[model samples]
Target: MTMPTSLCPYRMQVHHIKQETPDVWTLSLFCHDAWPYEAGQHALVSIRNSADTLRAYTISSTPGVSPFITLTVRRINGGAGSQWLTREVKRGDYLWLSAPQGDFTCAAHPAGRYLLLAAGCGVTPIMSMRRWLAKYSPMTDVEVIYCTRSPQDVIFADEWRAFPVTLFAEEGAAQGFIPGRITREHLACIPHLKDRTVMACGPAPWMEFVEEQVKSLGVTRFWKEKFFTPSAAPATSGLKISTLQPVREFYAPVGATLLEAMESNKVAVNAACRAGVCGCCKTKVASGDYTVSSTATLTEQEIADGYVLACSCHPKSDLVLA
Candidate 1:
């Protein structure tokens, strides 16, 4: 069956909850009907209570492996959605979720060799791709490097042992694992780094480091997914945005994302995965000078043609969006 539309949210029952770590839990959700999803795509999950909270989570389950989909969530100290999923939700609980959406997937860009780097909970999407590759593309050579605080904090550690995996622990070291943060020296050890496709996911800092390292190696094909919205620097100028569909205009303060600015002014815009990894908030720019922090979901031509991701874009000057 086809996936549900973004404008429509589907209800899924929690089939089971598995605790991978003290702070991380995996929730298996069963839909009333079949829903197809690719590995590495994420879904926007919402908790319908007094306060409606929505957040996007990467799917960790491989397609066709089971009748249900899975989301692995890590509890953040003050994060409402993460805390709800980890502490409040349970089996038989129902959640409203959007269809699978994101561009970070092996199916989108196939390669002969892949080096997957993940830190903390960022391993979710990479693990999905790994499972899919094992079942569908056995001939492909894949290597995974997962970084966490310690061995006790690693998610799905036992399952990852079956593959070519390397664990990097910062606080402590263990046998068959590296100690300390990932560095350029570590990336230099990989053979023919430029010839392999490098996909890294995790916090913005970790992904930025990985991106710089990959660029230094002259890697042509590199993909990255950040779970959190990028922190934008203070803007020097304000923005004037004009929308066409509803025919509205508004003034956005400097350093504010277009999505945030529009939402604050009560402008309706469907957005999911505000990190810019999902293309849900893509809009045509009628005219504007803007700076995008991340372009993982956009093509080079699209940027040239005045297309921007509203979630991660900061206005450099006055803007008009179509």
Candidate 2:
């Protein structure tokens, strides 16, 4: 069997489906052969409906714990990818998945103690780390704060009972869950917060707020796996975006993401997360001036080499991309 690469997707059959909540499901997909990935990585899952639509979903199953990959999907009302995966996909159905990608794992960024902050479905990656730590480094101090809309909406409710994890809900009367949202007080309440490395995931805005609160509490090491924040519609500044290897050009607006314009113009490129988090869309800018929302998974050398996340990058001047 061949191993999957970042750009080459592999087919995996849905082996099992367990409903975690009314709107959320845990899907176990057969790897056939072991899939190589770290706990905090995500895969680009492609589903076929009217046409093929792909979306990034964090792999919730820890590699050392399960031979198969599991994706916990929350059914979004109008989200095509989530809706299809949660409602349409069935056992035995095969889904195309990109290789596990991202660097938001303890293996990549280790700490003596850790603070995990997850909101809603963002719990996927964060909890996967907890599972990984339990298997590989049980003595490591780990604190968890998971926020949900309500207690009933919490995914992985059964498994959490065995661990020391705090659950917060905006509403819903639950015996153990804290009422209302995660506040600065809750973050400050973590003992020796200064020494823990914080890993958080959720909507981009929510992450920013959590990061702010985390920093305010004297914590310096903060890691986040990002969710895409869609840019506002562009007003057509007519900037030229040129790509090589067949060498094509397209016109885009100032605020338009490079990935969006490329796809619209039929210029092929590998991309996932459409957010800066995945780094799947990182490309070398032979010549260009642009602004990127975040350099989440990139290294200093890659940045110096002019590598930019096409998903978050907005061209400022006429651009030539490799």
Candidate 3:
């Protein structure tokens, strides 16, 4: 596969950090040069201490509002990358980051009305879209549905409250908030549900639930960004991969994702949104058998062209990659 040489990594300094929730923090990064990015896109970030551990995070700040880029991250208990950013990283520290990438943006497909659904830290990208609409498309009709464990867990609560928002909480319902998980009945009541474009972002199970509910409502235009990967069955065999760019070969462990395998063997493959929602890890299979997960961000034509998302694919047999 031919990689874009212009998408090289750049360095940014951490200007500030703000703790939003107990487990979530937002980092403001100052770039030496102008950072061009659209709302709802993500950046691939790598810490200086953990050179090989790269992670993708959505850009939370609007394009024209600030000189710096912001990323809101939720620290998972044992996640090395998240833990490092929330606990160890400090202001003045520098990190390597790739240019913004991903197709989960409203600019790609404009709609008359929009329904934005988000849960937990998944609100980051949606927040970007919201800010953009508030600034550039002020007259657009938009509604937001946000879910969290409790009132305290809501990220950007103040900003979100400025718009038309419906909150769902698992505990302690507050004013303008509902209790429990979003149900089909809840979605069924939305006026003109079928006419509005739905954009959802959240954990895998939450996204799946929302997708089914929206489809049941006869909504035709739906776009989603899932932050977590769905559970996959165990792999029965190992795989051998040949990579291009910096030509190299490696052995992938059974059940390991192609991207994970490549990373384990020290083969650098530019990847963002490791959950497979982004096409950054796309590669052409020169000669190989592979089973790509259903969550892969690939079109039918791309699949026919022998392209696969390394983050969501497992090798079915020894493979040779372009």
Best by lDDT: 2
TM-scores across all candidates?
0.76, 0.76, 0.76
Tens digit per residue, CA lDDT, model 1, 173-250? 889779989998888888778888998899866898899888888888999887663233333336777788888777
Clashing residue pairs in candidate 3 are 1-322
Candidate 3: residue 216 lDDT (0-100)? 83
Worst 10 residues of 3 by lDDT: 228-237
Report the C-alpha lDDT of model 3 over 1-322, residue by residue, as the tens digit.
Answer: 1222223367778999999988899999988876799999888777443445567888899899655799899987656678889999999988777788788888986987889999988999888998888888999888888899998999987787677888999999888789988999988888788998999999856998999889988999999987743223323346777777667677776656787776556564666567676567787788888888744678888889888888888988888887
lDDT of 2 by residue, 1-322 (tens): 2323444367788998999988889999986655799998888876562223467889999987876789998887666678788888999988878778788899998988999999988999987999999999999999999999998998899889877999898998488989998899888989989999999998766898999998988999999987553332333458998788778777876556788777556566666567676666778899978988888888999999999888888888999987
Off by over 4 Å in 1: 1-8, 49-52, 229-271, 275-288, 292-310, 317-322
Is 2 or 3 the stronger prediction by lDDT? 2
- Clash pairs for candidate 2: none
lDDT of each: 0.81, 0.82, 0.80
